[model samples]
Target: MAGPGGRMMAGGGPGQRSIDFKGSSKRLIARFRPERATICALLACVVLSVGLSVIGPKILGRATDLVFAGIVGRDMPEGATKEQVLESMRERGDGEVADMLRGTDFTPGEGIDFTAVGDVLLFALGVFLVAGLLMAVATRLVNRAVNHTMFRMREDVQTKLSRLPLSYFDKRQRGEVLSRATNDIDNIGQTLQQSMGQLINSLLTIIGVLAMMFYVSWILALVALVTVPLSFVVATRVGKRSQPHFVQQWRSTGTLNAHIEEMYTGHTLVKVFGRQEESAKRFAEENEALYEAGFKAQFNSGVMQPLMFFVSNLNYVLVAVVGGLRVASGSLSIGDVQAFIQYSRQFSMPLTQVASMANLVQSGVASAERVFELLDAEEQEADASPAERPDEPRGRVALERVSFRYDPEKPLIEDLSLAVEPGHTVAIVGPTGAGKTTLVNLLMRFYEVSGGRITLDGVDIARMSRDELRSGIGMVLQDTWLFGGTIAENIAYGAAREVTREEIEEAARAAHADRFIRTLPDGYDTVIDDDGSGVSAGEKQLITIARAFLSDPVILVLDEATSSVDTRTEVLIQKAMAQLAHGRTSFVIAHRLSTIRDADTILVMENGSIVEQGAHTELLAADGAYARLYKAQFAQAVAEVD
Candidate 1:
């Protein structure tokens, strides 16, 4: 939908929060309820596992206390007791001592029962097992949800790209858009699936583990938790430093991708000019920048785990010394001391995870920001009301005082007016920057006009649904684009109804593409890769023309459709153009005078204004801009032939 300043909002969809992260996480988290459920389950596992794990240490400590109590019963002196005998006896009575491990009033089977303790141990083991499995399930669920959302995001971005104002692409590099569509999306997918998944689990696990730690011993819990804030501060520092680095890395890669794409597209020109060294030098610089950025970012992130561990170890040492003193003073039980250490680790582990996730979280945030930016781009204006769609549209187009500009400061099409009656052919000819293509752009609503208006059968085009307006008109671009698909599929690109073989052949024949199709081994079924393959440039252009032909639009736009084709192909395309122009309104942008010689009206634009307009003979009689351009262009053509 439209937003402030009449900009189209493409950033967020259903359940998506705004790109800004300030207070946005709360909304994003709420929208991600399924992922939140997985987080909760992970927390359950963490709490359960931590609780069960502490029991082992408690059991060992209880056994120690029981042995100490027995020695006191035997009236053995601490200094006079034989160390070897104590050790040997303790080993032999290990199972029994643990069974009778009681804090007080341990005369017989009053406080501690070894049999019931065995049951407790088994229960703890079972809890740990179940928790592990639940944790695994939570992980799988989180990944599934994240991946599904990311896939949808990629798809949505692509769709928006397709519908965006054509001017949006004018100032952008193809490589940069390509990188965002492919590489940026891929990075985001990995972060959400692998890294963000763990981050969510870790957050919940930390909360649960800390709760258990406090429940066991608040004093020890406090001691264990001291590392939390410390680690967090350190992580924040490192994360801040690394976040920008990663963003830069992403940008640098986009630049590199752009360079690569440009090189590949112009490989023949580069070779002809013998500029391999210059290209290699540029690539080397890009590669070196990428390597440095990657190394620094990873190295900084790597230091987090070790730094956190060092803090954890310090906390561990303090807990052991302080807890041991409390136990010796009889203020704490041996089991309590043992459980404290386990809880301490549980408390610190999540902190470690939080530290580690800083890298991924930052990367994800950066990517999300970029994706949201694209989605936030302005969309063309909506129609005032839905126009009545026709099964077969009438061929009438009028440009009344139509003016446009890529930028407001410079007008491309001045306040010029033109009209095409039903079944009429209009040709536009101009110098390189004379707004020839800009006329087609406005008619297609690829960009809104700066002034005046254009209409189809007296109904203002701006008041018509973009889809209905475009569907009524067919376009053949100068540069033909074919996706990786079968020739038949490409030919039937935008037709709503399924195209029959006969219809496909008919369109192909009209475009003079049928000859090439039959020459291919697979004919219409020939599978083509995105790379130039199994077809010539002229053949591809013909196929695109055939696609437009199959749509059966009442108005046709040919933007230098035959400019890139060979002489023979041009003749064939010219014949096809004549047939396609019959019984329809057609707009042709041609640099070649020969192609537009027979057009009913020829409008020559210069500096965004129509300086010459009339029939061929009429323009020549006026001896204005059109006549000069014709003579200059035609003279070069004759010289080239000679």
Candidate 2:
């Protein structure tokens, strides 16, 4: 697996079957120590197999020439030297040589003992057997290490996704990122495991065979070399053409997966809106695009193998014609001609394997580039300084002309100033998109202010470590998230001190959640699904409130905490809030006027500035922006009563 900064972790799955390592050469090298034992074993196997195999072919050619020379009475014609003769005989079929020297020369039925041939054949067979065993073991070992690395890569990518600044997800698509981590990595794995294994073995065989051919007939080897480069050129051209198509294929796949995920998540919405047909049509468009891209990529890459074989076959014909002539003219032995045929196939096989793996290499490279891009992402900055420890519970927070925006050019909070004294409940009232949430966000250190500073007890929030600053305050948002766990676990989330069952129950009762808890089959022990999706929104909200109460922080922030419930629940929540906010400084954000009526100060905000600020009655007396809002809510309350 590739780590942050493009370094591969020690363990990864086997090399990709398709593209091999592609862009991760450094990662592969970093983990080379684990692979070293396997590589050494594989190299040993290849050396033994190739050396023995090459020698045997040459040995058989010499044996044939020697027997023919004896028949023609011309001292073997000296076509090959004594060393070449021995090698040619060693290269032939192990069983044939064994049969020829089955009995001693002293035995009556023995066929003119070729015992040296038997000895060489036995050695070659032993080498072949050992090589085969070692190669298999090496392949398995490499695969295990590679698989581990791939698993780490997936894990690292997931951790990055979670820790990345929230802003990163705003611009990137979920499905595209998922594709990079999952499907792309799997493709790389498959290519490494199967094709890469074959490629290595085939490559070694080809090189060994080529060397032997050079010794046999340099001219014929040159002719074969010409065809080798041509095959590579063709494979390269085809791969270059196929690469864009493969990338498009994966891109389309991501789009299709995104739509599918969306549809599944919003099935109820789709059904209610009667948009199934339209959804299917969109899906079809994406699916068709994927098919076209896939066909183009696979089709082009698929043709490369056969093209290489075709080129190899042409070279084979030329070699056979040229070699046969040399043999007939008494310049080459019949055994030499036979050996050339075997070497031709050997040289061609590696090229064919490479051609077949070319597309895999390209695809892996494409996927690797995407993976590296994500791993290279800039992490959200965290304060490196040690957390500051305040002497006393000042609980005072002040925004000194604090201004901020999600985008730098577009200001959300413009020269906004607010102050909350220790033990004061400050209610922030604003129309939609009036930087109400933005103010709280700054206090939470979720986003940095474009200008000005927010201070906790006179210390800039930014100067204090984010965790420490958040630790001093508790927030209950409009949407509550509860992990899949028991109710007790949920309530204890942000608590600084250890919470007992009694404390948890006390918090729940204060939030009016204890009433519903007794009705549950398992009560506080009931397991919640992901995000508390199984629970009602009102109940989830009350649970979140209980959580805040349990935390018992010096500073509190309630952002529409009771807005999603019934009137009765709202009343109960108000009582709980009154209790929870008794001593601690609080910041309440709400659209409901009644919730904040008892607040020490109410700030009516419009645009990015406060339009009105005073006590409820004082604002009503002013007959300004607060007065207009109060009148509207009062009228609605009267109409509901009627």
Candidate 3:
């Protein structure tokens, strides 16, 4: 089930789950191999600590037996001491009693040897103190190792994301990617930090306690071992049942987060469309699913601890009864019985802990599998050996028999050819989904052409490195994006080299954004929120235009750049665009027929094919597709005027 951070609860249950415990564990262990020295030291400390723990109870039992013997000796026949009682036993020819009391150091009148008991207690205290110190050191070492490994893991994930192609992101939800990067990584980190050391120590404790239990009495050890298989069976059954639910839980959580992000970002549209109730209903459905999954996972996994506790208590009862019988029969001494009982509990304690941690361990493996999936995703193909870089690039560009399809079965553009010389404007006009922006994406190398070549002045763009090709091009998209930074920073974002404050202002002025900037409370220094919430859409577009201007690119791509502005502002932006495109090649993708009427060339695209291409007036004179589109827009404009 989903947790507070929208993470799935531990132990994802069955059905085509991707969790490979053995494989993931091996990889996880390989990641820690570099810290083997520290791990070894930590293990050494665990051994020492558990060794001390195992011996302490046995030593304490000796003290208990001494006290009992002293009490019995002093209370015998009206305050006779241990030495006197032994002498009386010898005088009465009780050889067995004399031998039993041989090592009991007791004074004639005292009930117990306070000095010897104090010494044994002090020694046990010292052992525990050292064990505590070792454990503290081990804990610190574990933290350091775990944090270091996770730090490197996060770095790898970040680097891997940068190397992945845009297609990878196109196929997945943003929230799903984010969940893997943040929540899943954090899960791995927490599990390693919390469970890794405990697992090691518990295992060692179980082994040591078993050995000590057998050393005390094999029959009692067998009684304790009886409950172990039962505990394992229960834990395994519960864990197997809970695993799939955990997977579903995380999958639903990712979906829910994606939905929330979409709704929040588009809340304006939701309210405008009167979809609040519908949105709330969708959220409730997701929330209820998360709750149900979470409850089942938690309930199934949660029962493990109590079930293990019952087995432990059952083992405890068996040990007590069996050991009491041995003690009464003189097969086991009172001291041995006490020590055996403590050992039995100690042995079962780790079993209980491991049983309870079964779910967490499984959850960690699931998280690891998800993380590995991202890491193992197909990255962008590397550039060819000895990749070429454009030198002294000209603004000339050509699309030679270009063909593309988002899906191979449904071809979009086929055998398309185009060429633009330096210092010319090419206006591409089309309806929505007519592959207008797709052409721009191909030009920018955001997506490679399916079967064709796009070339710069002479060299094919496919041969040049993506960074080199993109470095000479500038783009302004329909959806303006401004990061959370000062207004000047957004404007200066286009420049690869450092830009001076004066240059930033000049670009803004050219884009007709300077007047609005000066009116703001902080002007160019004003901090923009992530969504640029306080800024008008037109203003945001202007800022992006200014950024493109500052970049001084040899080729410019403006796709719906002026779509958000008012008519007056559009006129200003068009003037700015004219100046920006004066000495550079530009591709202008626009929907408005009036806007591209002055273009040097206009290409009318329909269904991903160029139906008409010519100067605006020429196309209108031919009375082709462009002519019909212009007539429709012209009629709409006149209707508005009337």
Candidate 4:
């Protein structure tokens, strides 16, 4: 049940544990299976584009050799023709090179063929243009696929959240859950959109460039290949070492965000306690930890590019030095040597990209793991198959030797039995932490009973679907919740069917909320903020009462329903409650002894067991736990009045 923040450092910022990269990556890859056709097409474009890029340097090298051949032929003696010069050049054992140089215009006195050179330059430019176009198309296709895939992933995560049980949220911070939903998903989307295509293109370029380099000159290819292992060694080592830091960085970010959210939401409380300095100190500590983690992660990732660049430059030097010797010995042409140098440089470019992208991939995988964790969390039990449905349910209820506990080691309720006839008000009074609310929770099926059974009208509540059982009961809690919407909409929130404006107004009047609501400028149409900030606590409570009234439930449960109101408002709310409970079964959990004096039966609870049960006069005569509680409250009220 411990959330991400609990796993973080004590008195510091957040930290995270490592996850299984292989499993997460496999799941992430499976998300795109539906887009296989688009991926295949993207791959085709990549191959076409990389093929053109790989061949361009070699074709341009042919032009360089052509220019060289023309210069050599132009310097030939007057008696010797250009063809004779070419025959001598062919004897140097470059037959393929000689064939490529054929049909080029060259004269004994002329320096070179400008027209032929222009044609070769134009052909190279055309190849580059075609490759650029293919690259553009491939980029567009990748974006489409990435965005669609992300859309589906987000939808799945959202759906999963709804299916998760209330218990899952009880142990986690709101900010932590939101961070996974927003920040983690965004990271996954960005990595896939920006880095995925680059990863594919870099890999293809590396393969194609390597093949071309080997074809041009195996010796130079071998020299360049040496950097491959060195690059991998540096990247793999640095990447693995930096990954934990990146995970820590993200976890710290989520923790810091959660802290900020809590502080902001409770700013009034912090100020009231004059704890500003303490809050700032805590924030600074967390911020410092985040800074440290981020610095280490970025620094480690940054080292890869420069080191790979150095390796590439060193390989280029070796290729140049070696190829020059071959050219000088007439074993290789100037054009061939130039082409080999380009290929050597191209080979390392993709390796450098892959190294640079390695850190981002690691961060992305970390995010994916968190997202997958949420999706894989335990969900609420499914509704009973062919679930029972009761027709026109009566309000009679019973608990048969029920035992319950929040923590199994510490027993709360044990061997308790109770029964209530239809249309009777049963008041439950208890000290703090006496399991009053826990009993209500069990009855509502919020938490299943650890032992025994609770029933409504002899039908086991467990056999009925949660929705079916809950539909007949209305709950007005001490903490009232109102969403951002019109006041009328809030009041009619849980109605089984559409409620008329007249019905809404009637319910509001019955809850004593109509007078105050009418004072607002928009009246029932007034828009409330998310926290019902504009309304007072008493008013918020009234609205919740009105919501319950609108539902017209068969049974009502009010947990300290009048706790927040002033004395005058409390009296009015009491009257409203009297009218609402006249003919319906109601369970009232109240701390105010005077409020429940007229209850048909009063149950005095302590710890988790009912210690006293009787009418008010009978309980007082017994001089037991209920008598002591009523006397204590009466004395307290008298002291307050004096």
- Using alpha carbons, what is the TM-score of model 3? 0.92
**For model 1, how does the per-residue alpha-carbon lDDT over 1-642 read when each residue is reduced to its tens digit?**
544555332222112232344433343344456455556765565555545544555555555455444544444333433444345446887533332333322333133455655665666567667767766776776677777677677887888897787778887888988888888878777777777656756666667667766766778778876777788788878876676566666666777898899899888889999998999878876766666556666778778889999998998998998887666554666667777777677667778877877677666666666666777788656566656444447878888998777777866777889888989899999999989888888898888888898888877888888888988888999988998998998988858689898899899998888987999999999999775488988788889999998998889999999987888888878887888889999999998888888899999888988888889999988989998998998899889999
Which of candidates 1 and 2 reaches a greater TM-score? Answer: 1
Please give the range of 10 consecutive residues that has the lowest summed lDDT in model 4.
6-15
How far residue 103's Cα lies from its native spot in candidate 1, in Å, is 5.2
List per-prediction Cα lDDT, in the order shown.
0.75, 0.76, 0.85, 0.86
List the candidate numbers ranked by TM-score, top first: 3, 4, 1, 2
After superposing candidate 1, which stretches have Cα over 4 Å from the reference? Answer: 1-117, 388-392
Best by TM-score: 3
- lDDT comparison, 1 vs 3, better candidate: 3
lDDT of 4 by residue, 222-327 (tens): 8878777888898888887788877787777777778888898788899999989999978976776677778778888889889999988988988999887777
- True-vs-predicted CA distance for residue 87, candidate 3, Å: 12
What C-alpha RMSD separates each model from the true structure?
A: 8.0, 8.7, 3.9, 4.3
The TM-score obtained by model 1 is 0.86
Candidate 1, RMSD to the unseen true structure: 8.0
Candidate 1 vs candidate 4: the lDDT winner is: 4
Ten-residue region with minimum lDDT total, candidate 1: 9-18
